[model samples]
Target: MKVVLASASPARLSVLRAAGLDPAVEVADLDEEALLDGATGATPAAKVTMLASAKATTIARRIADTVPEAIVIGCDSMLHIDGELVGKPGTPEQAAERWKAMAGGRGELVTGHAVLRTADGGIDRAVEGHAVTGVRFAEPDPAELGAYIATGEPLVVAGAFTLDGLGGWFVEGIDGDPSNVIGISLPLTRKLLAAVGVRVTDLWESD
Candidate 1:
């Protein structure tokens, strides 16, 4: 079976490649802000999972004919802190403001995963789940934050920080799967694939 990733996040792609699976990228084009705004969900996990499912299903339909007998994976990440859920900061000022409140604090990084098994130009099975990791932040000095913000790393990533890039400098620790904070949760993905009757290792590229 072929493996397809329905996301445009470099972090998510990097995580999958590092884990031995070389999935074909199929970036889903959607108005994410509109979806989130109109979405009805009581919890962060639910909202993220819904978004993941939408992405997966959208791409699954697009490629089901060409990539018959394949597993499609979709993922989305968000940060939950101070009773609010936040995605990418999207701007320097917003990034800086988020970091100001997040510094020396803790937040839950939740990643939603969805897997679809396609057969005969349609989905035969689907599964979805979510993972949450506690991220403990370090207090970077104002100057350090300004420099980091200038790099523009945090502006495009969830939680306005990263675990595998410049933002790592201010991440004190993580309480769960480190990969979850980076973007996708390996363990969760594995289970989701299994739930869809696909073995993750089966999708690994042959050496």
Candidate 2:
């Protein structure tokens, strides 16, 4: 059986690799349009968990044959501010704007991951019950926001920032796994990987 990661996020990829796992990569190809259709008062945690599950299930279904006997991991994250879900910024200006609004103030970085496995011809799914992390950002200057956007990192990332890169300086502190801010939490990944009998330590000797 093989282990596959269903995402195109470099941050997630990097995180997994750092944990000594060389799992396969398959993008989730998730579409957020359907998930954000007027939550009407959905909590940020609820919204992101839903999106994460959708992405995981979609990828699991798509790659069923490709890895029929393997475990597939799907993950998604979102920025929550003032009870609003902030997806990835579609444009540079939008990213900059988000940075301005979230710069000085603090917000929650909620990342939800879903682990899907097939056993006995049935699917076993695990939601974010394994891990959830909250991160806070330091005050960012309006000018710096624009500068950060120009780097193009914020364009493809949620919350328009990367806690592992230049954006790290802007974070005064974090309440959870710092890697979670990058996209995926290693500790969480390790825990979930265990359900499939893959230990974080074992990956060190994986081929």
Best by TM-score: 1
Each candidate's TM vs. the true structure? 0.97, 0.86
lDDT of 2 by residue, 62-107 (tens): 7675555667777778887766678789898788778778866777
Clashing residue pairs, candidate 1? none
Show model 1 residue runs off by greater than 4 Å.
205-207
lDDT per prediction?
Answer: 0.92, 0.73
**In model 1, which range of ten residues has the least summed lDDT?**
198-207
TM-score of 1: 0.97
Native-to-model Cα distance after best TM-score fit, residue 76 in candidate 1, in Å: 0.4
How high a TM-score does candidate 2 get?
Answer: 0.86
lDDT of 2: 0.73
